[model samples]
Target chain A: MKAATFLAALALGAVSLAAGAAVAADGPTLAAVKQRGHLMCGGDGTRPGISAPDAKGEWGGFDVDFCRVVAAAIFGDPTKVRFIALTTVQRFPSLQSGEIDVLSRSTTHNLTRDAALGFDFSPITMYAHTALMVHKDLGVKAGKELDGASVCVPPGTSIERNIADFWQQNNIKYKPVVIDNQKELNETYLAHRCDVIANFLPGLATIRAYQAAKPEDHVILPDVLLKEPLAITFRQGDAQWKDIVSWSVYATFEAEEKGLTSKNVDAALKSKDPEIQRLLGVTADLGEKLGLPKDFVYQIVKKVGNYEEIWEKNVGKDAPLKLDRGLNKLWRDGGVLYSPPFQ
Target chain B: MVEAEARRLVPRALSLDNETVRAVVLQVATAAAIVAALYLLGTNAAHNMARQGIVSGFGFLSQEAGYDVGESWIAHSARSTYARTLVVGLLNTLYVSAVAIVLATVLGVLVGIARVSPNWLLRKVSAGYVEIFRNTPLLLQIVFWYTVMRQLPPPRRALQPIEGVFLSNRGFTHPVPTWDPAHGWMLAAAAIGIGAAIAYRRAARRHHERTGRRWPVLWPTAALVVGLPALAWLAGGSPIGLDVPRMRAFNFQGGTTHSPELVALLIALVAYIGAFIGEIVRFGIQAVGSGQREAARALGLRDGHALRLVVLPQALRIIVPPLTSQYLNLVKDSSLAVWIGYPDFVSVTNTAINQTGQAVEGIFLMMLVYLSISLSISLFMNWYNRRIGYRR
Candidate 1:
């Protein structure tokens, strides 16, 4: 079990055996997080919409807000979070070392990561595909036209293998110039070191919309090289902590499906619907099951808003990336998002 | 005499007062402490990794490396094994290190001689070069050179200073002789010519010793080398072709292209190391006393002959030992190529670690490879140092 801390307790006779036992009862990671009075969330800090700092140095994005939802549920304060900037190579190691309580980074939910890396991913947060972006002057409309092209890829990402597999299947030959950082890869692509760039579709769209010198001059090829279902990841252990994180995110979808916006949530406290009353914490204490307050869902929605609100504010039509809610809509709305009943 | 003998002895051989016994006991304790510390660290790491569910060992080397290598001499693809990727990465490291070593040595020797030159302009320029390159950080210089390379004209607007060589941001390309079976015989002739020249030089030295007559070696050696290859060309009917590069859709197609990453890495390494090596060479030349120069002058040797025959051989003895360290440093510093997207050993190993999540095994291999490379360089330089020492 928690041998490291248990040995230290035996050494110092520290904090009373009762307090140590109490910590073990709840789970090590959450108790430690609570003792620190904040949650440490880390992610790729260079991507604009997924998780990066804005012009005022404030962190705002889908991933950053998702981290806030967890924070708000636990501490009842959306501000109880510190964001640690991580590179793709640094993400898993940072999580393994306890540098971050949760990886709100937009990482793919793949089997190897789940099993081999010892990570438990939350519900699929966003669905995207690895796509290629090239300058319009290249006159290439499809990925098949990318034969003999030099492609710039961020090193150590799944995008590298995805593009390679794509090329192999199509019988096309291409050169890969793997830059370690995404920001530098964009520069190299612009410098014509590469004729095309392979990245996550949302990431490529963010680049084309914000980082590009001329947004319209570059076109993202319509090809799904690989399906990337991004999610919130945490260390694999502590079933209670997993339920807390997973259900906290599920609350967002659950609220959106129930027509419970943050603006309308308070008025819906009196609604006749039994599930809505249970979800809003007016009837049942679902939050208490995960060791939060009776109204943790209400706290999360009030402080950070629901899934639709977070998406629309971060990467939607009015946002810089202006991405559509393509596959992220609710299940009844012809998309894949659905939440289990609050009961 | 009794007191001196008593000082060395003890009441008991096993006691700490016995000098040799004390020394042995202290060394044993220190060695034991080191071994224990290392064992603890190893076990602790293993425990923590196991608890975290992270796997260990080098078994991942045989798995297919799904990523493509940037530049590799060996055959590498997404389908190749991770072990093969390592060789490709190592070859890339060795290629850059080898080229940088030779070029830095040449540049350094020239600059060192110029620093002490009789002319005012040459001395000042060399001094300025040493100061500028040595004072700044090598990493900054690499990035500066990369940015400079990126600013060059695109492939379509490449600057051609010669008929066949093209220069662009993509990289420099020059016309190379196309492959032919006849060229293989020419290469073989060149190899034989080199062997013949070495024998002729030794024979000429023997003749000089016997007759006190200087046999012309340079002209004869050059004639044999060139004459053999020319004869082979004539016998093979003189087939020749040039693979010239021209503009294509995305990049130059025919001739070999040196990517900007390689060019930038070379310039940065050569310039930075050349400055340090220049100081070593300068101190080495100065270490040869004025007495040696005078002795050669007493024999009526001219200035060039005096410097070559007397001073250089002595200076080389001093230069080789320190030059060995610089060579080792240049090889290790090439790992910085990872930042600029050059697929050196560290760069590719980093990707492997990321993909496999086997940080321990990947890092151990990296340390092993670099350590081996440094040791080989050290050994070769030590051998040269021994050879250049004064003979009985």
Candidate 2:
């Protein structure tokens, strides 16, 4: 009887071990992040305002800041994040294969992506649109005059489809050159292999800033191809992790609306207002229900700053990109960047 | 006494010396294990995908691709289905493979012969060509070719070394024959002429075998093949016209053009695969014994005749097997055309995967297609090998 019982227990253990591995493979990314002690974020390390590495090999960009925000929320240390630079083609696959905890790449959130890719996207981080950039010598003002011209594009993006649709609808014929790497595409375009370069507006701005021989000689056509919402993506089936990320993004907006900045986070910790107190985790431990420390929002603001600060440092008028926060401003400021109540 | 000895012997099924039974058992065990492993992997992937909420099915193939391919041999649009896009990609892959294989074989044979040439300069140059190409990586060669091609002069100053042909950083443009209704009849005449020429050669061969008298049929066959098409075209008033390319505002217009991507991919595939094929050809020719050449020479065969009749016949027997593998490699390597936007099979599937978020299905389709192509190549080569091999 003892021997039979031992055999039964051993068989049961083996079965349970096999089942546990399968569940663990698709289970909570939160536990995996905690166990790994750092967040692995997928992003393009060359897009200046989005994600780029400094001379010291540390990444500091808007997308990189988002990764830091997630890191701060989980570990209370913004430095506990490792950014894995991925190309346009590699971002989704990297997320699906569980190579990264979150994809902070400037990827658009659309119906196809939301429904098809086994991933969930957080609220819109930025509103992006595709545009064409051509040499001043081309003597063309807009996309309409680019008939029979060659255009360079980065592969595995919506830009390729958008350009095709635009040209076809306008009854113009053009050739497309799909270079897999954005940097290489820019080089090829500058080499006159293509007549025009088509990419997202911010991407084109970054490329022009770094790669062009004379940045002023290039003209960004006033034609917009497609508007999309760029968001942080994580694998689906982990609703808890998705909610955590979503709320974390909301916290940034709520903080921005409350006139909170990284420097003022310490002072806000002592606020008397009930809403501000709950948001800073002073009056309520709301983060516990989301499997985080109650000071998650406080850590986020303290480390990565609010959305306004992030925008100013990375892509605002004073930055190298010098981009206006036209549509990315808070909802009250006549922009689309909005968040639900943190309570 | 014999009966008693037989009865004393162990039964074959129980005996270790039963080789047939043991072999069957081992093979069955291995096959079962392989099947079980495959089943487990498939089920695990399905379960994990389901748990992750990833939709897994071929239904996405019918969805619109919504992307433009750089160059396609078939009719394609932004609204084309993924299945149609895959077909276009497959056709493009075939086109590159077919053209590259023919060009590579021709170049390889010349280089191989040059490598063995008695002239010192010819041999050294051939050796250098082989060493430089085969030693460099194919991807680097492709990128280098593309970069060099991209550095050509702009459209306004496109290099027109020859009249009616334009070369620029954009691409190569030259004259193409404008299609006419009469061209269809011309093609049909050419086909019929080829058929008649083949029949004449067979008849001549039979005549020679029967009467031991040589019939000079080469000129007549060539005349029949060339004359029939010319005659048909003339009868149809020579409607064909040359559509020469001309430089327009931003690009060339009205001519057949080879895109920079296609040119780069072709040059890289030919240069890289040609070198490996050259070595194979050289080894094959060298494998034939010197005695055969001596015997042919003693029989009053000239150098060219001896190589054609005595050496190559033997060399080809060794060359075809490895040559088939190289051809398949070229077909597979054409996928690297994606690096330069050539819209080959893997590239299109990648776009489809990205567009539909159907990575598993797209990958599965690619595997099936590639496997079918590889198997077809293998089967054809095996058939050819059996037909040409020395019959014992």
C-alpha RMSD for every candidate: 4.9, 4.2
Give the candidate number with the greatest TM-score: 2
Q: Which tens-of-lDDT digit does each residue in B1-392 have in candidate 1?
A: 99989875657657676666767766665565556555555665576666666777788899999989878897789999999998999999999999999999999999999888889999999999999999999889988898888788888888899987888878788888888887888999999999999999999889989996767888989988998998888898887789999788778888888888899999999999999999999998999999999989998888987987799999999899889999999999999898788889988988888788787788889999999999999988888888989888
**Clashing residue pairs in candidate 2 (N, C-alpha, C atoms within 3 angstroms):** none
Which stretches in model 2 have alpha-carbon errors above 4 Å? A1-21, B1-11, B14-17, B207-221
Give every prediction's interface RMSD: 7.8, 6.1
Two-chain DockQ for model 1: 0.32
> Would you estimate the TM-scores of all the predictions?
0.92, 0.93
RMSD of 2: 4.2
The clash number for model 1 is: 0
Question: Model 2: which docking level applies?
Answer: acceptable
Give lDDT for model 1. 0.86
Q: List runs of model 1 lying over 4 Å from the truth.
A: A1-27, A269-272, B1-12, B199-231, B390-392
- Steric clash pairs (candidate 1): none
For candidate 1 chain A, the 10 contiguous residues with the lowest summed lDDT are: A14-23
Summarize candidate 2's per-residue lDDT along A232-342 as a digit string, tens digits: 999888888998899889889999999889999899888888999999999889899899999999999999999999999998875778887879999899998888987
